[model samples]
Target: MAYVLVLNSGSSSVKFQLVDPAGEATDAPLVSGLVEQVGEPMGAVSVTVGGQEHREELEIPTHSFGLERAFAIMGEHNVGPTDVEVIAVGHRVVHGGKLFSEPQLIVDEIESMIEDLIPLAPLHNPANLDGIRVARAMLPDIPHVAVFDTAFFNHIPPAAALYAINSEVASQYDVRRYGFHGTSHEFVSQQVPKLLDKDPATVNQITLHLGNGASAAAIRHGRPIDTSMGLTPLAGLAMGTRCGDIDPGIIFHLVRQAGMSIDEIDNLLNKQSGVKGIAGVNDFRLLRQRIEEQDQDAWLAYNIYIHQLRRFIGSYMIALGRVDAITFTAGVGENDTEVRQDALYNLDMYGIHFDKEANLVRSKEPRMISTADSPVKVFVVPTNEELAIAQKSAAVAAQARAEGLY
Candidate 1:
């Protein structure tokens, strides 16, 4: 049986999954591992197999070197590089900039396309490109497929997506809204119809992906009509370290009135703002602990984050009328019980009924937490982005083989 390798490379870490397509499996990863602190002196590597996990610390300086060492370790465990006929490599390319509406194999033209969008996604695309280049050099014979996070929102209507001013500037620089988290949104959108046993073309719903980086999408009949993120990841709900939805005038105000440099403002917004800006730390786990201990700043920060999130959710709920259901997925949405319950508590007026018992139960499955008589259903569906990548890669690889193109 052939195996598909999915690689999600970040600036300082990499996540890999080995998947067996033909086996009697349920789309779960066969084996998974992560290498963290790639360029740091005290780096670490960890892998899990057959319900067991392991970790080790070592010195590593780059993604390529860490990947080479990871493969060697895989060999030691008998799941070596040659154990399966690696049909293709699927990568998570963060920003496709309207260039890639579908998955495409790596070639000179595609590489050029990625390079062109570097300025728009400065912090993300470069690390993605580095991974692609290193993978090409290591496995010259394997097909590499690029899946994008912006492709799913390419269908957003012009009126909903267009800005109110500066048509010329927007046209020249592609400054219009281009949503992120397309892969996660698409995965959950498709999963909804399957869970409801209905045709995907006939269902309409809203999905909230609330993780460290959060975004929401409104889907009507399987197409994205609107999304929370706009032009960049910084436009949506507040993130772990990002100050989302700030007034545009603040940038100039800080420079002119406060005598702050552009870099200083940038750092303040991207690193020191959001929950951290209010409470002096970014991690929600610790933030919650502080709030429980009666820390006033922590209480204020927590309530502020929830208020922003509730505002967005109420807006999307109105936009997508006659909503079939609402989905909560990703880290914060799935695991944080208090956050989820608090966000949904006062929405009973909007045809939403909250079940206290159901909402308290936590599991790694698609679960319905709304009351039986509620007009709109609320569910917690775990996001499987890596498995979605593997499925798409397998289909594309099979097509390439049948056409004698690879």
Candidate 2:
């Protein structure tokens, strides 16, 4: 079967999936794998195909070698990278900056533009570039497309996009709200209207993408007006490893009184300040267990997460004015019953009525967890970013072919 190889490359890991471009949004990948600890002496590889998982630990010297080895493992399962025809390649680029708002056919100039925006996403864009370069080199015959995480929020109004800082510096550094996890947000928001049995064009929704990395988007009539994430992914709701919204003075205090360097402060806020920093663990399941065990720190972390989430929900409700649905998506949002329940609770005055039993019933399919009498609907819609990438990549490649760009 022809498939699109979707790659989401991180600094220390590379995740890949072989997706059928024509498949349903809820369809699973034909093959999937993750290569972790790239360039490390001891690395691990995990591949899943046809319901079985194969894992091993080795010295994965480079991204290229790791991916080739993963493909070899897939070959044993009869769906190697080269075993079947690869129609196109889809890459997840974290930051598109101001240049790209839609999926782009990966040409040399496109790659250059992506590279140019690396500073905006220093931790992500370079690794994304690495995946694009390596995949293009490995399969030079097929078209490669880049689907950016920030592309969906590119059209946000300037008021919501810009910060109150010096305009010159902000423009010089391309600093403004870009909103990450946009592929997931866009895909999930599109699915909401279907569940509501309404036209996509008229739906006003608030989609909370809660996971290890979470963000909220206020989508009005199918376009994002404001999102929780700002110029960086670190600016939104408190995430697993990120502090989310914190006072700028805290950074100053850390620098002046705590004697922390800029890099040290960056590391503190980005890696050590979220739910993990407070509870000593990042996984929601573990955090929930701790909360049930009456761990004060874990309880505080959970309250912080919910408080921040509710703040966004309230603000978004005001921003959208007429809200249709509020969707809980991604990892924690889709599966966690209490998190979903607590997020929209006690809002009877504001047209939100949470159904306790419905929220507790877990399923992969999109399900509404709101009462019938409520004006605003609440849903738990599972997100499928890989399939979104495949469909987007296929469309971009098809467009390029029609325009004779390839």
Candidate 3:
């Protein structure tokens, strides 16, 4: 089997997945693992291969150290580096900053571009670059490709994307919407056409990826026409701990009137706000439990979240003009039954007919949740971002090989 390893490195964790070019056959796990708490207490690496689980607890001081251990353990378990030939290494690069529109094989110039994007994605791009540098150091002979998160929305038209302000100011600061979660959005958007056995040009969708960092996208004919998140992941929907869609004046007010430092405000918005600010908790599961017990704050938080989500759905519908399908993906989008029901409950006027039973069918595979009679289809699609990265990496590698770019 042709194998490729895809790595997504974050501030505190590294998620690695090995994909089979032929796809997971005969129940193979598609080899995956996580290296968590890379530089802090509770640091450890866990791997599950072919239905077996192995975990090791050790302090890792850096991305290089953790990755070295990970490769070692993969070999020890017979899913070793040498047992399978690796075609390419796909790195999930968080910010491309208009330089990279598609997955590109990593090179000196590409590394420089990633560094230049650090100021825009301080929390993510640096760690991603760390992984890339370490990968280059360790596997100098192998082909490495950078799969970007901002690449999908690079073609968003001006009307839907451009702010209604001065063009000169927008250009000076590079202030415009560059949506994140492009990998997930692209994966699901393409999946819709493939699932319906129709050409991508014929499909229109509004996809919601409701994970810790949530965002929504409006795709028309397989292109990103509009998306919820803006220049950063902190712009659109209220996420686990992110203060989304906040007033710009609030920052100035806090700094001048409340006497808070910029760093403090940043921390407050990125880390201390969102559901945690109003509800004192971020996990939707925990919040749901409190609501079941009739906790007032929990009810308030749930209400606020549902209201915001409903508003986003309506807004995106207007953007799309006519919606063929709406998809739910990622953590909350996949498993949160209550949220699905709440968001679609009263949208009948929009020609959305939901199958309550189908919506409740919780499974790993993609399945339609809307009723047969519904004009607009709704679905639950489990996202496999690693696979998406791997596919893009393989395609780019093939293209480069054909063109002798490497």
Candidate 4:
């Protein structure tokens, strides 16, 4: 009954889960919860244990405070640090740069290496590091692992990774595509082969991780050959508040003609753009509702999102040459039926016969939404990044323990 605690720490929130890596009896988590609005005047923590949910509002002025409070709540269920034997703590680090291509045990030097990558993921890495540091301090007996979001895409071909810039300049500046949401993409890639009963080394898949932030990956033979996200998470499919795939000249024009500061331009594109910029809302459900009400802006945003997503799917299909399965995951991909419908509409030419009725059914389990006769399979696979992290973390910890390092 080796337990692994997985933590995904964002700039303002932390999602935690406890799981058994073996998962022989049940795949469900032993415990899970979230701490929201850290460093704000009003913050809250929510925890679920044994199929029961609990919540509390308190002062979470820092990641440390929020995590400590969460532990306290878990204590009520007898699953806290003092009661449970946690084998490993896994932190979802957003960027690993070119230095790491897999999960690494978090040591002093490893922490420093992660810190060096802060520039690559300014918004996510720091917060991830914060959680790692706090967790290490709280539970010094167990090994902590840093699972990277960019690790899965590190194997992408050089032709796909390198920018079309000067070789020396690109190398000096470390400019290359480093995809995000890799944990989800890798998990989906592995699952697709099992779902189809195909050999992992012979499978090809196009995975869509659509949420507030969205990205796509083309997996060939269980490895990523290409992905949508670039050096940052902002380069992928249109996201909740991000202007994805915009012309670089737009930045120059904003600075020269519009007199917008660099920071202002960044904020505008990353925070105020996308569906939010177009329709004044980033929520997919709300946008769909407004579209039902015949709001033109909402309709426009929806069209733009679907168009961009379809373009990527088509390109990835070409990149893979042939596809076995096209899997969708994440918040929007799993729950938003219209999004899946619109993106795959009229793709029969590509041998994709989307089952509209099948797509309309909402379920948490992985299921197909394409006709059995279709050349390519379409599936709604819920992304369980925490489970993936837990497995990886447990493996790394077990290895370390066997090597007499833990």
Candidate 5:
């Protein structure tokens, strides 16, 4: 089978999956693994193949060492890149800026362009670049493709994309709402039309990608009308540890009154806020347990999370005018029935009728959870970003081959 190696590299960890090119979106990867704690004193690596798992704890000093050991483990299972027909390596690049609206075959110039975008994604792009460089060196013979997370919503209308700040200043710094989690939103939104059996260009969707890191997108037809995320992932919904939407004046207040540095404030809002900031726990399961135990803080966190979610949902409903479907994907949206129920609670006036029993049913496959006769449908579609990236990478690689670019 022809497989695409999909890699999502963060600052300290790498998530890798070997995806069959012809696999369904919901299909499990042929092999999956994680190389964690890179450059740390004690690191761990694990690979799962054919429902079997093996893990090792050692110093994963660099991206190269970590990945090499991961592939080595897969080799022991006789499913390594060398043993299989690996066609391309797909990379999850966080910020493509405005330059990339689609996946591109990785070339030196492409890598350089990605590097140039590092300033826009200081925390994510560097690690992504490191992984790309290391993977390219390790698998020099195969095609490498950069699948951007922001590419899907790159064309959001000017009103939605621009910040109301000085246009000159915004232009100078490239400040605009370049939505994150585009891969998930795009993948899920496409499935909405298919499920409704409506034409892709005629469907309107509000996709809520609720996970540790959550974001919402309002897609009119196939194009994004607006999205919750802005220039950075920190601007969207209150996530596991993100502050989400907040007044800009608060930054000035913190600097002037609290004497906090920019980096400290950045860490605070991005790592110390959100559900974690209020409930002292970011995991939805833990927060739910606390709520069951009558913890007031947990209740507040849940309320804030749901409140912000409902606000966005309502706004998108208005933006679309005639809504077709409301989709909930990612972790929290898929598994947490309470969140799903509460997010759409009392929206019957908006032509949405949530099915209580249907919402309770849990499965990995994409399924609808709204009344059959409701004008607006609600669904819990699983977002398969790895599969999307792998498929895009395969297509881009094939295109490159046809054009003799490789």
Candidate 6:
């Protein structure tokens, strides 16, 4: 069977999945695995195949080594390099800048373009590139495709994408809103129309992807019109360890008064802030426990999170003009019922009537959480970014084959 391997490579970890994109027999992956703590003394690789999980501890000093070990593990499951045919490898590239608006077949020139976009995604693009290079070297004959996180927001009009700064400076620097989580947003937005049994062209929805890293997007007529995250993922909702939206003056004050270096300030805002900054923890479950114990700090963090989420929802509601549905996806969005309720509370004026009972039901499948009489439907959709990447990659590879390029 032909498969598409999807890789989401991070600084110290890599998550991968093998999917038969056209498989209709089941909705499960052929194989999935993760390599964690690369470059560390103790590293681990775990794989799930045929409904069973297997793990190993090894020295994975780099992404290349980790990926090689992953391939070896897959071999044990009879999906080795010589056994199964891999048609394409799909990479989750964090930034595409203005160069790419859709999945593109990776070539040497395209690789160089991704390298040039390093400044726009300092922490993510390099790792993504590394994975691409390694995978290409390992599977030299197979086609590779890059599915960008910023591609879904490429169509957002200038009125929403451009910053109200000096036009000359902004243009020179290529500064504008380039939303992240495009795969999740696009996947969830398409699912909304199917859930409502409506034409995608007639659907206007807001999708909230709230995981450790969170963002919101306003999709009008099946296209993204605006999103909460800006040029970087750090600009949107308060994340696990990010400060989210903050005044520009705070950086200057910290530099002049607090005598903090630029790197130090960046570390503080990106690593030490958010719920972790306020409550001394980043995990939602731990924060909820602290809240149950009447910890004021955790409560405050929870309040701030819900407040920001509600603000974005309200703004997107205005942007859409007439909202049909609002979807919640990703980890926090799909599982956190309290957050869902609090975010949609007191929105009766917007025709959003929350059904508390329906919200509390825990399920992985997509379902409506709004009351029957509510004009605006609320849904919880579990995002499958890997599947989306595989589907796109398969399509690109097939198109290339039709042109005799692959």
TM-score of each: 0.95, 0.98, 0.96, 0.97, 0.99, 0.98
RMSD of 2: 1.1
Tens-place lDDT per residue, model 5, 139-257, is 99999999999999899999999998999999989999999999999989989999999999999999999999999999998889999999999997889999999998999999999
Poorly placed runs, candidate 6 (over 4 Å): 23-26
Per-residue lDDT of model 2, residues 4-24, tens digit only: 999999888899999998988
Task: Name the top lDDT candidate.
Answer: 5
Greater TM-score among 3 and 6 belongs to 6
What digit string (tens of lDDT, one per residue) describes model 3 on residues 350-384?
99987888888878888899988788889888887
Question: Candidate 3: which stretches are off by over 4 Å?
Answer: 24-28, 404-406
Candidates' RMSD to native: 1.9, 1.1, 1.8, 1.4, 0.7, 1.4
lDDT (0 to 1) per candidate: 0.84, 0.92, 0.85, 0.92, 0.95, 0.92
Clash pairs for candidate 5? none
The lowest-lDDT stretch of 10 consecutive residues in candidate 2 is 77-86
Ranking, TM-score, top scorer first: 5, 2, 6, 4, 3, 1
* C-alpha RMSD of candidate 5: 0.7
Candidate 6 — number of clashing residue pairs?
0
Clashes of each: 0, 0, 1, 0, 0, 0
Highest TM-score: which candidate?
5
Q: For candidate 1, report its TM-score.
A: 0.95
Question: Which stretch of 10 consecutive residues in model 5 shows the poorest summed lDDT?
Answer: 397-406
